[model samples]
Target: MIKVGIVGGTGYTGVELLRLLAQHPEANVDVITSRSEAGQAVADMYPNLRGHYDLRFTEPDADRLAACDVVFFATPHGVAHSLAGEILDKGGRVIDLSADFRIRDPELWAKWYGQPHGAPELLKEAVYGLPEVNREKIKQARLIAAPGCYPTAVQLATIPLLEAGLVSADDIIADCKSGVSGAGRGASVGSLLCESSESMMAYAVAGHRHLPEIQQGLEEAAQSDVGLTFVPHLTPMIRGIHATVYTQLLDDAEVDLQTLFEKRYANEPFVDVMPAGSHPATRSVKGVNMCRISIHRPQNGKRVVVLSVIDNLVKGASGQAIQNMNLMFGLPEATGLNQVALMP
Candidate 1:
């Protein structure tokens, strides 16, 4: 069995990783590190995993983590880079679910994250871990950087159009919204039940950190610099992300939305391309690593509307991380991730 270690195993993504890994037959979660919750049973902190994992959380120790074959960094942005070098030096594979190595341009990363990169030399080596787009690269990568939740949903929804040369690269606009759980499992005045419930407001309108990451993916797919205007909003729900994307058609020819989408994601296991005019709800993908998307063509203009939905904590975070791990370990991509959406 492939030994696995998780750094920062108390947050939403970390807990979700534990949930998925517990059922992963080929993998063994040998260590879980948490600064504050060290020495506490993981089940004690998260009652949901009481019977599944009786392991106790430990403090971050590079020497201890180097023993594992693969280590997952579910910590904040700069935290992974601080410790990744030692792990990589020990010939251990790493999958970071943070922004530390996602953006290739170190200057851009510094601009958005508001500090210089901790390890600039390693920036060129980290592979962006979006299986749909970079599966081949992920197979050979020693360090895999998982994509952000918003970028994951938005890119899957619009990339096929950009790659097909069917949409104007400069005219694309993404007005995406995510549930409160995307904010993480932390206590905050803004994330309180009453504060977020019955309220809808847009934040990070001018510049979201995910903007550059999304642009990087689209630019690579289109083989050109793609300009995108991204705006993120917060909803009252507990999970999922819905991205409503608009783009102008490049040519006047008749386009079959369903045919195009179906053909694009035909071999992809987790991406579902719905029939034309079918609206997909968040409940359809909750607790699963599925991205449900549909499209529409308006008569007024050559404008195409696409709706994409995914569970921010699942497809957008931990589940996708596990998907990358599966690829890295030469296991079936769906080996430990064939979970159906948990519906109410």
Candidate 2:
């Protein structure tokens, strides 16, 4: 079994990891750490996992985590900065589901995250863990930085167009909506049920932190600097992200976008390229590790609209983290992640 340790097992992403790993055949949840909820039984906090995990939350101890084969950081952005390096130093692979090591530039990461990066020394060594794009790199990486919820949906939708040189990289718009869970398991006036329900408002329109990560991925696909306007809205649901991306086609040739996306993700296990003209709903991917995408060219015009959806906590965070772990260990990417999407 692949021994596993998780830091910050109290948040939506953390528990999501435990929930998924519980069903994984080759992965074992050896330790899960949380500073505030230390000593509490994992099931007491999350009733859904009551029968699945007997583990308790413990205060993060580097030496304790070092015993595991792999450690996942499902904490807030800077939290992983303090522990990731130590665990890696102990000869265990590390996968961070935070922004700590996702961006290539520490200065840019600090500019958006509002603090000096705690582990700048490890920045150069961290691999961006998007299995569709970096599968080979993840196989050899000792450290992996999983993409955020927003970036995962947006990038998967736009990368194919940008790489095929069929869309305008300079002018791209990613209009995204995410469920309340994306805000995390924290208390906030904005996240309150009364405040968030029956109402949808866009925050971080000026520039979301995920903008740079998305830009970084798109630029890498386009092989040039990219201009993207990413606006995130908080929806009333509990899981998933729906990104409606609009990009003007650069060439007016008879481009087959459906075929383009289908071929682009033909071999990807987690990405589902839906039939042409299909609108992927966020709920279709709720509670599972899947990205459902559809491509369209409106009225055969020079504009393409791509719709992408995924469970933010699954394909966006913890599930993708585990996918990286599977790659790092040479296991089938779908091993512990074959659960079908939960429906209403």
Candidate 3:
């Protein structure tokens, strides 16, 4: 069994990890840490995990964490950097669900995250954990940095066009909306039911942190510096991300956009490229590790619109983390991730 330890097990991603790992045949939840909730039963805090996890939340201890075969950091951005190296040195692989090691450039990370990276040296080695884009690297990675929720939806929608060189990279735009759960389980005025319900508003229009991560992935696909305008909105729902991506086709490029997307994700188990003209709903992917996409070109015009949706906490965070762990351990990529999305 792959002994696993999780840090910050009180958050949404953490519990989501617990929920998924509980059903994983080869995974064992050896330890879970939450500084504030130390000594509390994991189930007490999150009733959904009551029967699945029999462990209690422990304090974040590096030595204890290092003892596991793999450790997942489901904490905030800076938390992973502090202990990932120690775990790696102790022969434990790490999968971080934070922005700490996703961006390669330390300066860019600092600019957006507002602090010097805790482990700049590891930046070079930590593989970006988007399995569709970096599967081979993730399989061999000792440290993995999972992409953010917004970036996951945006990149899945845009990468195929960029890779085929059928779309203009200079003017890409992603107008994305995510549920309140993306803000984390913390108490915030913005996430309050009264504040978010019955309303929709866009924040970070000037600049959102995920912008750089999205650009990084797209630029890699395009193999050039990409000019992208990314805007994120907070929807009133609790668990999904809908990204409406817009890009102009290269002049006179008469490519079959639907076929291109289908072929790009043909073998990817988690990415579902819907039939032509299908409009994928966020709920279709809720609670599952799936990204459903639809392609369109209004009036057969030069501009193309792609709709992408995913359950933010699943594909966007915890479920993807587990997918990376499966790769790192040589397990089937969909081992414990085959659960269907929850439906109304």
Candidate 4:
């Protein structure tokens, strides 16, 4: 079995990793680290994991963590890159659920994240961890930088169009909405129940950080630079993301919805394109790693709209991290991630 270690085990994504990895048959989660909750039973903090994990949270040690076959960093930005070098040198593969390594350009990363990158040289070494697009790269990658919640939903929705040259790269727009937990487990003024519940409003209108990351992914797929307008709104729900992508269609470009998507994602495990004219709801993907997508023709067939949804913590972060881990270890991509969506 592959021994796994998780750093920052007290956050939302960390708990999610535990929930999913508990069912990963080929892996053993040997260590979990938390600075503030060290020595406290992990189950005490989250009762959902009580019977599965027997250990308590502990402080992180570079050498001890390096001993595991793989390590997942579920911490916020600026924490993973600091210790990635030591872990890699020790032969430990890493999957980071932070924004630290997703953007290829260090200057753009610094500009968006508001801090200089700690490991600039290692930037090129970390593979972008969207399994559908980069599965082969993930198999050989020692470092996988998982995509952000919004970017994951947005990019997966539009990438097929961009790759086939069906849409103009310069006129893409993503109007996305996410639940409150995407902000993380920290106590914040904006995320307070009084402020968030019973309300829906848009924030980060013109300059959200995920903007650059989305552009980077699209450009990579299109083999050309892409400019997009991304706007994210906060909804009162606790999980899930719904992204509506609008773009102008290229002249003489046409695709049969089911046939084109099926051909493109034939070998992919997680992305599902709905039947023609069918709309996908966020509830259809809750508690699963599935990205349910659908397409539409509007504006007298001059433009196309793609609707996509996924559980922010699942396909967007922790679940995708585990998917990358399976790839790195030569295990089935859907080993511990095949459960049907939990519906009410």
Q: Please, what is the TM-score per model?
A: 0.98, 0.98, 0.99, 0.98
Per-residue lDDT tens digits for candidate 4, residues 261-320, read 778877788998888788898889988898988888874587888899999999999999
**Deviation from native of the Cα of residue 321 in model 2, angstroms:** 0.8
Q: Quantify all predictions' global Cα lDDT against the true fold.
A: 0.93, 0.92, 0.93, 0.90
lDDT of 1 by residue, 1-344 (tens): 98999999999999999999999999989999999998999999999998998799999889889899899999988999879999999888899999999999899999999989998889889999999998999999999999999999999999989888888898789999899999988899999988999999999998999999999998988899888999999999999999999998877646776798999999999999997779999999999999999998878468999999999999999999999999998999997899999878
Ranking by lDDT: 3, 1, 2, 4
RMSD of 4: 1.1
Cα lDDT for residue 265, candidate 2: 97
| Per-residue alpha-carbon lDDT of candidate 2 for residues 35-135, written as tens digits (9 for 90 to 100) | 89899999999999988989899999999899999999989889989788888888888999989999989899999999998899999999999999999
Off by over 4 Å in 1: 252-254
| Stretches of candidate 4 exceeding 4 Å from the true structure | none
lDDT of 3 at 62: 84
